[model samples]
Target: MAINIRNAVIQNVTGNSREELEDTIVDAVQSGEELMLPGLGVLFEIIWQNASENDKKEMLQRLAGGLAK
Candidate 1:
């Protein structure tokens, strides 16, 4: 059976508070585990979908700057 990872990630964090979500993201990044990437991608997808054009531009700029470093 193929599991929908995005849906599973969303469901896992459905009721998380802002701080809790922040902790989750921080922990995932700090761990440097490859398995955490799909969940992070799902979180980014949600943020990207809801973000305004200006927010998206800022994110893109930051991403580009980070990549350049």
Candidate 2:
């Protein structure tokens, strides 16, 4: 059977507060686990979908800057 990772990630955090979500993201990143990458990707996808064009451009710029470092 196949699993829908994006839906699963969303369901796991469905009712989280802003602080809780921040903690979750921070903890996932700090853990340095490969399994967490897909969840982060899902979160990024949600953010990208809802962000304004300017916000998207800023995000891309920050990403490019980080990659250059």
Tell me which residue pairs clash in candidate 2: none
What is the C-alpha lDDT profile of model 1 across 1-69, one tens digit per residue? 999999999999999999999999999999999999999999999999999999999999999999999
Against the correct fold, how does model 2 do in TM-score?
A: 0.98
Model 2's alpha-carbon lDDT is 0.98
How displaced is residue 34 in candidate 1, in Å? 0.4
**Candidate lDDT (C-alpha), each:** 0.99, 0.98
Residue 60 lDDT in candidate 2:
100
Residue 68 Cα positional deviation in candidate 2, in Å, after optimal superposition? 0.1
lDDT score, candidate 1, position 60: 100
Q: Highest lDDT, which number?
A: 1
